[model samples]
Target: MSRWSGMPRTTRWVVRVIRPFLQVFTRRDWSGADRLPTGGYVLAPNHLSHLDPFLISHFMVDHGIAPRFLAKDTLMTLPVGGRLLRGTEQIPVYRNTEGAAESLQAAVRAVEAGQVVTIYPEGTLTRDPDAWPMSGRTGAVRVALATGRPLVPMAQWGAQEILWPYSRRLRLLPRKTVRIRIGDPVDLSDLEGRPLTEDLLHEATDRLMDTLTTMLAEVRGELPTRPRLDVRTLEPPRTTYKRLEP
Candidate 1:
């Protein structure tokens, strides 16, 4: 059977609904689609705007991969939205609670099941004033390690142009061009089968972030003006999801 034909009803509905709107509203410049795997893999993308998930999902579904997001638990608790998310088999991440560790275990299972699970290593939108990717947490790396799935680094730019970070207002006028570039799976060959130490996770996460930043810069055709913002250095230590933090 065709891949779309095998997709859950909710996932098909999402593709039918969101993909068309994105195609109509924005110009797409997607590359490196050949890098996407047919089997289970961890999708690590840089988070730019709230609209990012839809755009990334569109790219994945168009290429015949059904994306399962590691979304906030609150999104999974919504009345209508929650049902759809559950029906589509997306994973819920319970942050700052006892259930936090459970989400990581769930992601590992999904990968082992041969499903695409997207995790924004940043945990939330970029804190960079220039919209560059910031330092990432280790949750994504941990999942990849446990399941031995390809941790793919995906970079997308221009979504922030349509919807700025933490801003509710959206500018759809005169169509914005969003570019998404996918890179080959991150080389975890050396670290694979090693003990999951704190320093090891951080190293893997840093490599993932560096690949994302480099890919994003290539898409934007310029280098980042400042070094990546490390959330740990903040006086208060800003954290979006405790479950994903290093």
Candidate 2:
């Protein structure tokens, strides 16, 4: 058995039950799944809702692939939820903390072992409120290039309408529709043998973001208003951990 086989059985059971319920409630539609690489790969998706990871996990399971996500370390502290997270072999990422490299190394090992690693390159959920993807961090590109894994750019919409981020509430009154679109894998063969530099990583990140922007625009049926970074500069650094009582 692979090291990932150690993922908690309880977590698997919970996901098996909960994912179906979520699908039914949201009336989700998934497309372009065939485009996902069967072997080791990185899934880069736009973050808009807390439900984004679960939605992607459901589709990955349906496709006969197991996705080990890179989640913030804080989520692993919730009572029942934390136990399930540990059981799933999900790696913890200490955002903006000194231990980020160690967390990233864990992700690298997972990818090298031919596992699917899902990440929100944007680091945090969109602060735009409209849920369009913002400029991404270089973590995804660094990990992908380091492991020589294929990067799959995924675009999703509708989850925000179900469980809106920042609203801290679920909208169950009106049944929401969720759509997931998996784009073709991005080839990074040209950057082989070279160190993963900030410039190259940023360029690749932009490519991923551009693809996501197109998909999101198609979903919303309109282009999003560009964000004013100057406003972001005025705010304090966001923390990766959510303050949930244990």
| TM-score per model over all chains | 0.92, 0.87
In angstroms, how far off is 3's CA in candidate 1? 3.7
Instruction: Put down candidate 2 lDDT per residue, 1-246, tens digits, no spaces.
Output: 543244457646766688768766877778998787766778899888788887777777777666588987998999977877887788999987888989989989988988888988888677664667888887888888988888888889888786765556667657777788888877677876687777888888887788888888887799977652222243443443232111
Stretches > 4 Å off in candidate 1: 233-246
lDDT of each: 0.87, 0.77
lDDT of 1 by residue, 55-149 (tens): 89888888888878998999988999899999998889997688878999999988898888999999878767788898998999999999998
> For model 2, which pairs clash?
8-87
| lDDT, residue 193, candidate 1 | 94
Q: What is the lDDT of residue 85 in candidate 1?
A: 91
